[model samples]
Target chain A: MSEYTPFEMIAYTGSRVLKDERIVFVGTGLPIIAAMHAQLTHAPNLYMIYEAGSLAPILEMGMPLSVGDTRAARKACYLKGLCGAFELTQRGCADYAFIGGAQVDMYGNICSTIEGHNYDKPGIRFPGSGGAGAMAANCEKTIAIMALEKRRFVKKLDFVTSIGFGDGAPDYREKAGVLGSGPYRVITNQALFGFDEATKRMMLLEVKPGRTPAEIQELVDFELIIPPDVKEMAEPTDEDLRLLRDVIDAEGYFLKRVIKK
Target chain B: MINTVSSNIKNISTLEYKEKKFEYWGPTPDESRKLMVNKSHALKDKRMSLKEAVGKHIRDGINLGIGGFVNTRVPVAIIHEIIRHGARDLTLSFQSNSICPELLAGAMILDPDRVSIKRVELAWWGYEIIGIAPMVRYLATNGIIEMDDYTNYGMSVRFKAASMGIPFIPVRDHGGSDMELVNRGKMIECPFTGKNVYLLPACHPDVGIVHTTAADMYGNARIFGAYCTCPEIAMAANATIMTTEKVIPTESIRSYPNLTEIPFPVVDTVTEVQYGAHPGASYGYYWFDMDHIKMFRSICEDFRKTGNKDALKKYYDEYIFGCENHDDFLEKIGYKTLKKLKDMDGGQPIILT
Candidate 1:
């Protein structure tokens, strides 16, 4: 395929990660696009649960600009409200939590609330956890998308908005009264990450073609479990790119964008 | 008291916060119950002006639960009225929202005494797909207002608990996170199973504002798009101020009682205002006027970045304060914009007959 933008790559990677016939509790923008692309190509039965309370909606209208947009609620199998959807996740119906965050730790604890130490005031305040926290907590597994930056991949998050493996402890989530197994994948443009089962620390599983483990490590603030068997990240096919651009995000909503420094 | 099961999350995040005593943000469960008992439950004609509804119930130091998820079916017209009427030291409660809170924040920025937000108990506050809420960033980062964050489920369940007339409800989220520590929820060992469960306090707002797809004169609302915590907020509040896209006949409502998401008793006042959630979307009626939302958002953003209120004041003067009613504001928006938005809806099926 021709050269693609970073966002297209992320969406493509997100699409590739999903398994068929499972429910994915999706956040707005890229996650929705990724899930749509997956349905169009590979995982046809992968229904989506928008946080605003619609399950398995047919996206015939267009790409919903917001998770709560009327388009997200069009022709749904079930539609209620936030309580109904999240409660379903808590009840073990949702399979994957497709989310994004501002900062993350080695254990995959995400911080989307604020950036500074003080909870009252912060250096920078992003949006609070809309559904990411509950999704990460209750959905069987979590898949996070992040910009691979040293500052974002921190030693300790300023505030943990989503529960991952706390302190790399095995019984952390169990003790926390949460139902999910916890953070399964962290997707970035440069690399794909999975947590080590024994240690529960973020481990590098794959790197983009022509990118080395050392190069990816340099972008991160914390140490990574870089195994020697790191595979090359798959590039999107031309068909995938066409579906993303021509069909899904034709309005240039999410796919056509610049990453903020 | 039961022994608390620890997530062992202490000192995980680089956060410093004072421990807050557990207290209801609004009315206690008992007080809410007392108010409900004393009120008239008759199916009287509750139709009134937005000005009267807002002015009658809105005041300083009251919890205001707003409805809608982000922009869809948001109570923008009611928000405009609240901003115009002016309510100070308000506590906002919602699961996730965008414009309603932003509009209030913009009003507060223009004149603090006129409209001030003391704090917000929320899951999220930002314009999804549009941009981050500039006002939340400006106010929160600068320590202008206190914030208590929860997951969207936590906030919704809090209202659900209140609607059920319960003091607290157990949820399967918000345990191993910072919200467990920062928010007013308590983690207690479940007496039944001996497992840890987070119990969040019920949220009963003094007044709840919501915009719905259709309603009768008695205020039994039927929401077309995502219900988005509207019914819960209305029932949980001591009083509800509601606006509807169209007032369908009560006979139509009675024919299908199952369609009424919000029964009439919970709602104190109902106002028929078409395109009520304009700038936002109303299912079967219209789609979002993205340009207009962007226009208002950029205005707020400009004031945030530049520390100037000239443009902000102009917005209030022109769109809000200058117009006496929602129809007047819609007139300023004109028929062309309304028509275009309607065309975008593509006639999603909603029953009014």
Candidate 2:
């Protein structure tokens, strides 16, 4: 319904990962945006629980500055504890766990932890692992959405803080003892992929609207199993683009990170 | 001729022809009002000690107001003093949208007791696992505290009331049906003012403590920059204690009167405490001692695994208690150790898992 920028289209792909009437474990940044779009679209029944204890119904536009963003509070049903999301998911009350990715692997395993080899030594640093360790092992179904490019999609993570694709095949989920099958989906600018429920290996399902499977494949370092049914990703709906633009209230430098030329 | 006494004696009392000297009891010009001079006594006052002060002012039932936002401008030295004394059972109130690190020092490091409050609201800084977001969760699930939240505007409005010594302030915050649950939940009370009004209760601390860059002998404090509502809270409190980075001559500060925030008339005690905002570094003085923070986090993580307070205590004793002061603590968490942390891993990464 609306003109979609490449960025908004990526967000739409992230949002489309959510099914109607699902309980979502929302993370900050892009994940928050995706969940909000899902709520605005066909999945109005989609319920979101953020790290700050907000179980939001209607999320405002833009990336929430933090979990305590007014939008989260404004749209939440109840503000519960932080681990309550995990507890709810553990109890099977929740259906989907949506998170973002700094570095993701073919196995769906994630590295939200350290950047380089040494504990003290680092090339790039971030705040240490949040609740990802627990959520990855426990959530019913996990979805990881990353906007950054291949330097982020590493062959092997420095640390396996979140078990997306771990070990390999049955051994990965088996090693994780994941109550529900761990991370199910991985969404990137290039392609959309899901782990085979049986083997727990990633299967490429779709590509971006303009890009070819071959073009997307070369950028990633890992082997991707392209489904014969792969199709072009749809453009972001009008609401999706509007929300994305509104959330990123940028003035100069910061605005440039996500906006187009 | 002056002694020639006569009817002119009365007339002689006119203006003196020769210069006459006048003397006064006050200090001499060289000794000016020592008000500008910096001064300190050992933390000797009974009620003024960090522990006793927190105990005396903060009772179980009343909501406690802490000054400082998130990590940047936290009153760390005071918090440590409270921890050392082990004051428990508090419903801490904050005016900021999110927390900084110093509060974590309280919840995770010092006091194991749960913080009881109506809301755990902040503007930002709630997403981290090891930070306030997770700590709040652990407490709430265990029924340690209640979550009464307000948005950024609501927090400022309410804190303004507390600082002003008002019982409650009505604001146009939380104004939608989406806010109905919180309103009905009694966290948000709406009075029938014929307009959308939310009544936020006033928060008063028994004793308020703040750290300033400088103070005079009389305890008039001047924060170098970045003034949060600490001064306002000080005005509303029954008594205020200040720990200054250094004490200076009253006259010296008088030369730059506009820089002063708390006048001596409002102050009770002043201590020349260096590195008073430990864990939280001064704005322009230094970046956060992240290496030290990581050590604190590592110790906290170890405690989290064992669920043992003794381990935390041991860590505190080894690192914190062993230090003579904040500098001593900083020395032990050396730059070399901080440099080594990066080598231990690739480095800290911000993955979105």
Candidate 3:
């Protein structure tokens, strides 16, 4: 078996979670790769709408470097302004939106704004929320992708840049006027997690191959809400790994090269 | 120099203002009156060379809007001129940006004094840094510049509010998010329904620069594809400057009135510059110069690794300073590569009239 990178696993799991015929509102980085993989594999009819205004692009070339990558507009069916694209999401046409963050809470809330408690004087200040806020509020379902680490998988976020499900109470999102049903899944390196319908707390859905439940539990900051039938995640097939390394990421922009150090 | 004023100004009703507790998303009745009044006035032909436009309009510490989405239809020639002129302390705003801001930041234009303090303030309405250029990250991390964030939709709606001459526009997105903390907006209860909505204030830049496929001498501009925020930028800015690949006849603009993105009345200046969105794609005109972009990224990466100012200086010297103007810059890119990019869109070079 060929050794697969954690990024491939994250991408594979994300693609698998996405269903066919769903219009995906995609951000840059890992989400682009996952969407491309899905398009190539199970979901050929997956329509992608980039925040930069390209809609339903064929993505003839490999994965775009960013949502604004020129490839995103190549042969696009419709080109809109930034406002028009989000307006569609607000109208609830987008079934899923893929987002990444610096920190995620148990309720699936994402914090990409700052690290420390103080907003003005932070331990670390990230590039503040862009479209993540709007995507979280409007998209019918949000799929959050992040690195699995103790700090990242926090019990509480430093700041709520995007609300998942406020306290995970029933009708919490509805009260906030969010059109979508908060986060459907949180895909990380070690395992896959889903939000509890009632509480909105993240529950360990499945562990990836070679990684034990105990190993994932160690990494998470919050307590695990493992169900009785917790199963091992399916490993990337030979074909999946081959397509990822060879076709989608032939240039190694995402897989091999670490642009953001 | 050919000079002609735009004679057509349609009579649109100005909105009237009645004191309402709820903030409208568009122009209020009173503000609509001003916009309608502004629309009635004809725009004089203020055509000039790209150099003249930059010199006459741009100033230090100016709030500028560089219009484009990602790599599409960026006003590259105007940006090159701003760099060439050494404009300082610019507060740059964009909804969805690409290489233009990064190039400025990389050239040390954002920090002309070589001090750690940034001369530029970068305000964008997007989630992540979209470009491959490293300057944005460098500025944010090094505390060189003040970074203000807004959602892509939030920023665009703010522009829309400015275009309509409104004080603020109410939006539904930022109600529960922490966007309200950094961004200047208020969560007010809707008087009619008692529901809450975020009210985003209107933002009008000192100058809005956009590149379009064609514009008349009167600055009636027509964008071919993906008219991102050009119309809003044009209407919202105190002054609007347009760079275009071709300057067609006013009759042609009149022929397709509905297709015109920026009407003549809103345009302050127009400069005809071919290949104005190089290293970025101008839809239906040329594809992105990927090789050039790759080279730029490498330069940026090298600078990030070394923390050497000379690396960026060398790039500016080679790409921006070494070239006299847009034509010279295109020449440095060479005719072959330019031809290949243009051929990708099956477009012929616009012959200067």
Per-candidate TM equals: 0.99, 0.46, 0.85
Ordered list by TM-score, greatest first: 1, 3, 2
lDDT of 1 at A112: 96
Q: Write the per-residue lDDT of candidate 3 for residues A1-261, one digit (tens) a residue.
A: 677888888889989988899999998877888888898899989988888677898766557776765567667888767777888898888899899888887888888766666544455556556678888878899899988889888877777778687566675555454578779999986799997776778889999877778899899898878887777887788999988888888878777744353
- Stretches of model 1 off by over 4 angstroms after superposition: none
State which candidate, 1 or 3, has the greater TM-score: 1
Best by DockQ: 1
lDDT of 1 by residue, B41-147 (tens): 99999999999999899999999999988888899999999998889999999988888999999999989999999999999999888898999999999989999
Native-to-model Cα distance after best TM-score fit, residue B120 in candidate 1, in Å: 0.6
**Clashing residue pair totals per candidate (backbone < 3 A):** 0, 52, 6
Alpha carbon lDDT of residue B234, candidate 1?
Answer: 97
User: Given candidate 2, what's the lDDT at residue A136?
Assistant: 60
In model 3, what lDDT does residue B14 have?
A: 13
Q: Least lDDT summed over 10 consecutive residues: which range in candidate 2 chain B?
A: B4-13
Which residue runs does candidate 2 get wrong by more than 4 Å? A1-3, A57-63, A246-256, A259-261, B1-99, B102-353
Error of 2 at B179 (Å): 39
The candidate, 2 or 3, that scores higher on DockQ is: 3
Question: After best superposition, candidate 3 residue A119: deviation in angstroms?
Answer: 4.2
